[model samples]
Target: MLRPAASSSSGRRRRSARSRHAPPQRSAVVPSGAPRPPQRLPAAADADGADARPAALSVRPPGPCSPRWAGSGRGYANEPRRARPSQRLPPQGGRGPRGWQRACARACARAPCLGQHQPFAACRGRKRKKERERVFSLPAGGRARWLVLPGSEMAGLTAMEKKLAEYKCNTNEAIQLKLVRFPEDLEDDNTTFNPEYSHQVFGDDEVAFGYKGLKILLYYIAGNLSTLFRIEYTSKVNEKFDCVEADDVESKIREIIPPGFCTNTDDFVSLLEKEVNFKPFGMLLHTYSVHNEEAGEDITYQIYKADMTCPGFREYHERLQTFLMWFIETASFIDVDDERWNYFLVFEKYNKDGATLFATVGYMTVYNYYVYPDKTRPRVSQMLILPPFQGEGHGAQLLETVHRYYMSSPTVLDITAEDPSENYIKLRDFVLVKLCQDMLCFSPGNLMQGFSQEMVMEAQQKLKINKQHTRRVYEILRLRATDMGDAEQSRSYRLDVKRRLIGPYKKKQRELAKMRRCLRPEELTNQLNQIDLNMQHEQLEESFQQLVSDYRRVLERLAQA
Candidate 1:
């Protein structure tokens, strides 16, 4: 117990002292006809020397401590007398006298005796000791629980999970498709060459969420009863779908497609050799081969533009987009009937033992938006190069061919892409920079003067480049021309870019000043509505640093080109 031991002599003396200071109690019973002693009251002197009874006797009730008072008296006559408990001892621990320190230490080290009357005091010391030293130390000779540090287990778990059968797909064959709706849409190769456009479209966006695009394609295919599709090429499949069967075409087509796609060439080629030509759609655009000098063999390939007018194009397109749901993260099917949509496809062509063999590679889609009176703006919407064929320069060659096809059109404006990805941006930058280098307007002397109205006008007229893109190109080219070792040249370039970033902040400051004049005095000093000058400076510096870093990368690429 925290209190002193009852067996000790000092404890007895302390208990005796406590008992002497306690209030006396009355007995619950009294003798019936007990004679009461008459109490004499003290007299007090009042005003004018008049004698009066003591205030205590006049106003107070009978005291419980008085020996003459009986239990029948008015004061607490019905109340019962009870024994009082002993004073509680102060809790030990923390900074204290040396004797208390030694006692508390001993109490903490000893285990509790649960059978004791005061369980709280006996167990509380152990709890307090644990709280003071809560380190996770293991006991000696015990079976050690493996304490894995945070983050190491996940990598091992992922590797083990990959070995399970459920982690892999059922088959390795897939059909490659390129869906487009319009002719002019195939102008920009970036739509297909840029890696950013290789996205899966989930049906969450404005136009595609409810399968509207696929519905239109299905409707078109259903109306054309006599049309047949020719599956000119395939990869990783043994079956050949040459002339497709019209009746129950959707189910048959579904059966032909493997559970997964774009990975295994051997399986893909084997699957394509199977004959399932009951219902087919699409036709071959072109077939050719490239001579690989290193291998001294001619590698044949085919390019196809999907004919929307064909009978089964709609069902084929709908099936093709199913691949998007599996492969691309943000791929959504396009509306087949939209006159503005256009499709371009690429396939691998080879001679297997003197027999012509074709396999699917990749494809792209574009949308042609009408410009104001007499022109058209072709935008590349989506592009993909099959995983197996990626890094083989097929994307660049396909994009260039598309660009050349539209370059001859008098009504066609410069090509553009929608929400180009970072990889696409890099590809676009490389292509545009290479094209602009040959033009007189982007010469070294012209770039060193910074961006100008003349340069913008020239790029717009000759290269069909927009003003915003022109400004960016100028910055990139200017950085290329600049000699960073020269202090004056580097400082000039830094200040030039920083000035452009500060333009919006300055304009906003003007608007704020006008607003402050119209607002009431009470609203003017509100911290939330006001802009801090220090914060503005910090933002400008951060923006400039980022811009300079990006420009340096562009400049490095330009030098290599």
Candidate 2:
């Protein structure tokens, strides 16, 4: 069209323009009949010849919907268009807008075209995830969408709840204790029992936080008290969460039970076979018989007094005292090597094939504390009747047997208890009342009079009862003699007990008068306000009623005896 554009130069000019706009060409040869690879376009340049956008946003291959690929016969135009990273809409139910953005960002990172476009497959997956979330989500200010589920769906919800429930366990319920006599007892469901408490082993809450479906079975052979320790659970806390820790129940139990307990069931069962050779430790103190209603026969029991010097007895004792941790509150191990410590053990004497087999029924510990003027006070420390043997009068039998054993010693000034529990006190009341009822000083006629020094002297000299206990015995006997139906006798009895009950109040009144002399007027008034006389009177009456009720039970039992 004009001097006919320089033919060779025209071709060169067009090629130069294509080089500026298109992706770099590969120098490698292509196999014949193979289509060339798709090329991307470079971003337009500014007047200064610098790229218009960052490299990550500049390079973009032709999409399937693009017109440039339609005539290439590649069938790209027939396919669906992929969304650009920035142009994509978040999926309907996805992790909201944020999740879609995250998906898009991840897709872009893995794109062959750098970050220029998100792939179709990745976008589709994100859309499906969003739809799922939307379907499960509750509407704004509406009830939970899952509430109207069918039975099967409800069961699914329960499974979810159960899954969460496994993380927390009531340790008391989770731990099962059994006194295994036969090998079959281990497998019997009837033989299993739970602990009354686990706060001593766990913490105050008594919860094992990091476990699911926890089952800790502790089995001990009925005879010789050999242990079989085992623990089981569906899942542990560490398996689910990285930050939390589960209770180390085995270690806690180990701290209580001595070394040499069997962890294997076979080992424990083998140990039970040797129990026929197990005899009562120490010297035999007494033998008694009890009627077993379940077995329809009489079973003989033996009591033994053991010390650390007895062969194998020290180790046996270590195994025996471990029961205290499970049953006794505020339980602690004692120094068995101490000479003053005395152990009284009870065993069931059973004959198996003409050989006597002794099974542990219970035990009591007494520490002889030195009293002034060469006398010794034997203090009852810990007493426990194995659960299987409890409620069968073994406790009463063991207690009375121990009392008789101490009564013979001249050095024993009196029998006492260290921080006796309510149950022990009740047992002691019954035993002492039974023992004193036969004495002349505790006769009904003498009891009607009042508590006397004669009662104290006779009880101490004959039974080694302490002065405080002797007074308590007097009251119990007095209540027994009093006729509550007669107003005069009832009034007298009430007034008598009230006088003793009011002792602390009287002492407090004296202290208050002394305080008036020293404390300022405001301080004295504050103290007086705290001591409400009306409340004290009401409490006194309540306490007197309680004491009379307790005394009546003892009398009833005494009558039975």
Candidate 3:
């Protein structure tokens, strides 16, 4: 009853079951020490018995370049947190849950500073000491307290201990929120192209409406300065840039930005809407456009092989993965820190009036597994072409490009996709068929000879295709080789595929017989008889028909190719 998933939440877990290999890179980062302390949110309740309004979603300032205030107890500007208890009361009316949480968070931000004295210089140089101070800090409004708390005093408890205390105290009542602007308010055709905005606002599968951009930059704080982490931009445009100066950065970003952003509006929220460009920094991946006569237009696209070692890979992936939640059913983000996982990004290039623009087409993440003594196998984990780009052969191009990338690696054993969706299967079928057609071993004469070790060997050796996938290719190719006009040949091909489909049902029957240990032969026979054999046969036929239909489609594409 389990259909092949278009995307899998546990792609790595499935790969782990099949291959045992230490990832070339660490799957996760373990902090150097026992662990940092956890922050606590102060509790607050609206004095008025009315519902609280949801506050604006908060934006998590980039960690490295986070805005910091430098002043002791109350010296810093404290608009939200400086409110006295009397002022904290909901202005004679009820507030929303979001407002309530914000109030509690603001209160928590000022709690540590109440009548406390500490010198910031004492904890300035110590990494662990600074961490302790930051850990207890409220993610919001608490920036003011960073200047007052003694880092040493903050290192009193481990993260787990603090978490336990927070759990027992029920911290859910004071949720920390981030600033986010919903795009719903924008005119239907008004476009925003900032990758960071997309990250903060959209779910993975939720495509950005009227939004398109290829360049995603990530930045972090280093030595109290905002340092560029990496810049992932499409090279298809062939534009020049410099980000060293703040003004230069802004100017370069604005040049590529589409118009009608409402940037000049006086509304603070509209101002908060970042011009859809500035992104965290990362390496620039180039994209190429392929001319396809069949599609009737030239398709400009590129596949960037993203590496884990690349700066800002993690941040870029964090923003990029928002697409998974919105597009891929059961889609899960891959562990980018894992050296074994490889990310391939596809982008479409277009000219927007005067400027060259790029929009994300789709992407795939693959995990490379050690096959044994020397060879490696790359398994496609999750694949998604955004809904706008689907059915345009972009998926096939992405998959083939990945296959070609790994084909040159002598250590690669074979290429496989993990729990492929039906659409993915069809795409794979077409790509593999097109690839193998030129190989003499897959000629019609050899294919009609039936499945053989030669087909599997040739596929694995030449194309880095796995044996299981090779067998499937052989079946489809054989069907192509068989003429339906010959009844015997068609019947054999049907049975060959049906036997594979009926395997699980046959196994279930055997398992059922083994479970009838307490039943008499007559009773067991009755139980077996009650099982709907005709229905099972019908299911098999249906599956067979559907599969044949899919195979025919692949063959038709192959014929065209």
Name the candidate that leads on lDDT: 2
Q: How does model 3 fare in lDDT?
A: 0.50
Sort by lDDT, best first: what order?
2, 3, 1
Model 3: per-residue lDDT, tens digit, 396-495?
7888888888888899988887888787888898888878877888888887767778888889888988777787788788887889889998898888
Steric overlap count per candidate: 47, 3, 35
Q: What is the lDDT of residue 299 in candidate 1?
A: 84
Candidate 2 per-residue C-alpha lDDT over 1-561 given as tens digits, one digit per residue, 9 for 90 to 100: 001123366666766889454422211111222232332122221221111111222122332211110111111222212222321222211233332223222222222232223222222222222212111111121111111222332344343334434577888898888877677888998878777767788767677655778887788877777888888888774422212235567888888888988888888888888877777779998888889888899999988898988888888888888778778878889987689999999999777667877788899999999999899999999999988788777888888888888899999999999999988998898899888888999888888888888989899988999998888788998887888899999999889889999999899899998999999999999999999999999999999999888888878877876
lDDT of 1 by residue, 509-529 (tens): 887787677867777667325
**Model 2: how far residue 67 lies from native, Å:** 50
TM-score for predicted model 3 compared with the true structure: 0.51
Quickly count the clashes in candidate 3: 35
For each candidate in the order shown, give its overall lDDT on alpha carbons: 0.45, 0.66, 0.50
lDDT of 1 at 540: 94
Compare candidates 2 and 3 on TM-score and give the better one: 2
lDDT of residue 160 for candidate 1:
23
Tell me model 2's lDDT, rounded to 2 decimals.
0.66
